[model samples]
Target: MFRAREYKICIIGDSGVGKSCLITYFLTQKFDSNNKVTVGGAYHEKQLFINNEPLHLQIWDTAGQERFRSMTPMYYRNADLIILAYSINSQKSFSNLPGWLLDVQKYHDGDPILSVVGNKSDLEKYRKVETKEGKEYAQSIDATFFEVSAKSGTGISEMFGKIAYQVAETRDRAKQNKTGYINPESQTETNKKGCC
Candidate 1:
């Protein structure tokens, strides 16, 4: 029997950054141009198979309006992974990323994986933020960077696949450390159990 493990994730950024659209596209594989502004927040669940192991992702999409800013951090608490999305055409959204990152740093103590997503890659012709700039900023903050399009369905699957694998790896490492399981790759001692 396969046991399903649940991982909590949160999406956050300034308003109009396509946070909701990205989630919608990921779940439905279709983008709704008329998606209503997400108030307070919304929850979504997706089941996936990672290395033949059942996995559940509890995705939380938060409102980006200024009025909802104060309430957003509460949802981010205890998240397993946080997707910080910004529009490639909106310099303001990209500029505000640091503040959002700081908010995550304030609320999350477990060091959840941070993914800085440059959304709206379909509108690259109108992009104000350069790809290199986003990559450099993500690197500076020690986070993974992805340029994805909720519209064209470009780079979405690859990004999520990487996220799922990374979360699984983090969980496995935590479990091993907790049980004092020595990883043979880093072990010099003989007769040590090898990493599975």
Candidate 2:
């Protein structure tokens, strides 16, 4: 019998970096243009399948405003993946990544999978953070790098799916190490909910 597993994910970044929109788009495949600033945090879930086994992704969209910074480390305590986001059009957002990284390093109990995500790919014309800069930063931090657009729903699937797979395999090394590894591409259910 295949056992079900739950994974925790936390998305953190500066305010107005499109963190909430990314979660909304991933769960619904629709752009949420009316998304407001996340006050403290919002939780969401998606049921996914990996190698035919059930997996539950418990996601948290944390508030990016400076005032909420002190409250964020608690969410980082037990995460399987942490997405550090920045708006491509906002250099300030990108520049603040190290501060966010410091929070994770100082508080995260386990070594979670990290991803540096550049949001607002749809606003490429107004881009302030170059692709090379993002890539180099990700490399320096030893994290996977991706560029996504919540409005256009681009690059979300590949980025999340790949990271989820890596986390799953790592978490179940003994079971999954039996050889003939199958690339279990993600299949998700759109269950609407929130947690904070």
Candidate 3:
């Protein structure tokens, strides 16, 4: 049996970490040079095909300003993935990654897949955070790390695709455990729809 799968993802970071640009480029495959800052938050989604099955992504972009910090928790509910993004050119953004990670851990329920992203990779010359540092941080937290260039649309699809697969696999394991089934293939398919 195969059915549609949907995952809600929340993106958080400092004001100019390019969170909105990452979502925009992921959905449209084009960059918006004149992109405006997200005030409270923004919601966008797109239907993607993974392994020949439809996988829907609900992406929530939260404002990074101090005023919006309180509201960030509201979007974390029922989220399957939380992406902590930092700009490669902004040392402050990179420095603030742990704060954002703590915010999500404090507010979000259960366990969700966490991804650490270093955005604006195209500005390599102006990089302030080393890739090794980002990778180390992600490893310390048991999260995935990605360096993406939203402006050039580099590493966007691959990031999302891998995250989607990882989320689905995690969900499948949880579901299987609930059914007291060790082998996923042996699980009943009456209400199921897709393969992980």
lDDT of each: 0.86, 0.86, 0.88
For model 1, the stretches where C-alpha displacement exceeds 4 angstroms are 182-196
lDDT tens per residue, model 2, 47-162: 77755567889999999998998888887679989999999999999999999999899999878889999999999899999999999999999899999999999998777777
- Comparing candidate 2 with candidate 3, which one achieves the higher TM-score? 3
Candidate 1, residue 171: how far the Cα is off, in Å: 1.5
For 138-163, candidate 3 gives per-residue lDDT tens digits of: 99999999999999999998898888
Q: Encode model 1's per-residue lDDT on 83-117: one tens digit a residue.
A: 98999999999999999998999888778888899
Instruction: Please tell me which predicted candidate would have the highest lDDT against the true structure.
Output: 3
- Candidate 3 lDDT at 21 equals 94
- Can you tell me which runs of candidate 3 are displaced by over 4 Å? 1-3, 182-196
Q: Give residue 169's lDDT in candidate 2 (0 to 100).
A: 65
User: Residue 73 of candidate 1: its Cα lDDT?
Assistant: 82
